[model samples]
Target: MAPYPPPQEAATSTLAERVGKGPDQNPNDTITTSPNCNPNGQESPTGKKTQASPTAIPEIQWYYGKHESRIAYWLLLSGAKHFGYYPRGTFNPFPITSALRRMENEILQCLSLAPGSRVLDLGCGEGHISRYIAREGSFPLVLGLDITASHLAKARRAISGDVLRGFLRQGQVEVRLGDYHDLFTSGTGIKMGEWDGVTAVETLAHAVDTKLAFSEVYRALKPGGRFCFNDYRIGIPDDVVRNESDGEVDEKELSPQQRKTLKAWRWVMRTGGMKGSEYSYAGTYERLLKEAGFVDVKVVDLSENMRPMARWFWILSLLPYAFAKLFRLEKAFYNSVSMYEQYVEWGGWAYCQWSATKPAT
Candidate 1:
């Protein structure tokens, strides 16, 4: 383990630039949250850290806010541990499983793991990508960290029973409870600059403190360690969903159909806990990585390639949405439908694959 340099005594302007108040700000400070963001989950009414008994575990608002936890639960119930990357119609000759596996392979290639290299799978829900890394022998040591207990449980169970069990026994695979915001912090038990590379795989969205998460990743990686991820983020402004540039939105120029789509889009974002107020655009992600000392930042828009998957989800969700609408119980269903439709349309949001690296001395 290596010690981090002392915190720079800079102005807190960068922290307040996005979410108001720095990470070290008092609990009493007015911290802006997304729509429907749970106040109880942020801090106690007395502005003190909320604690729970052994029998009661306190929930942390990661990602799309409170509704995010529900989405995880539904994913588990649907037997889905992670989202799969799909090729566009041009590249759809192979089956989806093949395409997804191919995507996984590409991610590993981007990571470029060396022999006996240590890797961290940040926000590794159920360890899907982590298991793939072990099974593929991409790294001799792989650490999967997630805040979700149930996901970690499943990740451990799945890894132990799979053929990759040898890797687990060999000390090559381990899953631990950790918040991305606190990746290199002392309490996380992860060594700073210990990893050869890190893969987030659509995980940074769950970060409560995006700046801190990026800074921690920059700190945790060995110099020249690569960081890569696939993420869906805000591509356009909420008020003006179409014809946008530089994160600006104009309400007066939107078409009627666009406005309808925009409304549904907002619902999906709000319920998904995205809220668009933070660094939702692809540019914002690249900027953060650079600000955190990552170099050679690359952002590839994969929205079109993801259309096939979006279409599949839209079809699959129809049955449930229909049933829920018929019964007047379409709260979550409506959101799901909206999400799938917006994905198919590929507007107001973007699915992107990004890679960057810590500068080698």
Candidate 2:
């Protein structure tokens, strides 16, 4: 509407540098850069606007790359690749790593998966969860799939020495470059109905198309297989509903500051590969799973249980926020920090444990 502001070349490049090169590093060559681009933001010889290009947004991708790189680096630093589950809170007397181990064990218990079952860890970063499943649950074959090569490399390194038995007898776990949205469509080299269980941890929210992703998961699982994961659920305040129509929520009704906050929040989620446009609400996952041919779909609210960890994140976000504001990279910084704060404070989002079963014939 405002002429879409000339490509912020300097800022864009800086942002890209901060994260890593996006899917494409050359910023000026974007679909929007063409002179013949039409009113609908599409390139055409006729110069007639039809619809926007379906290409990924470079800024968002760059932001996510950096965000993921940061996560990988942090995992490298922690030597554990996770912020260990702090169900009670970070200040508790129990050790963090032990809690993390316990959390994984608890999740596996819920899955009721037998040893030697094949588990696919969707959106698996560093294969921490997959490794845990393999080592603890004795799930001989575990596959971790992620879009980031670096993260997958980290996962591979982390699970390198594992020597359990099953589909992949040489290694207890494996890592692959795959995206949840294209698990079935793209050539993942994994067969349908091959997995006994699939686990996604704080990952499904990042799905660009929740329905498509769910459907793909459905197709990937064996009959009687279980899909389990935890992720954020939408939880909006009463005053926040400015506009709601056509399967979209308009935040124009929010205050100017609130609108800016929402913008920053989305940028952060986008960096994590989460699509706010396609994100599901509290009860939506159950319905979507049902549509995807899943049965016994259950979405459990674990918001209170996850708050302690959220509190820790809130406390940790301070320095980054200051650094961004200091360097005037506030917009890029907002992509993650404030969005997390909203989850921690305003009930903007709820963390939930989800499980669904593919029924046996």
Give TM per candidate: 0.70, 0.71
The residue-by-residue lDDT of candidate 1 on 145-220, one tens digit each, is: 7766666677777767653334343344667666565554323456678778888876665454455567778878
Please report the TM-score between candidate 1 and the true structure. Answer: 0.70
lDDT of 2 at 3: 18
- Candidate 1 regions off by >4 Å? 1-80, 90-96, 163-169, 237-262, 275-279, 323-328
Candidates' lDDT values, in order?
0.59, 0.58
lDDT of 2 by residue, 1-361 (tens): 0111221112222322322232331112222223222224443334433222112434434644676447633642243333345555345523555656655665686677897687888877767678777666766567677665566666665554433222123445666666665554333456778789988886665554566567778878999999998776665343344332223446655556655545555656655445623345446677678988999988777666645545555666777866876788765675346535554344555667889999997
Measured with C-alpha atoms, the lDDT of residue 134 in candidate 1 is 55
Instruction: Give the Cα error of residue 331 in candidate 1, in Å.
Output: 2.7
> Local error of candidate 1 at 223, Å?
0.7
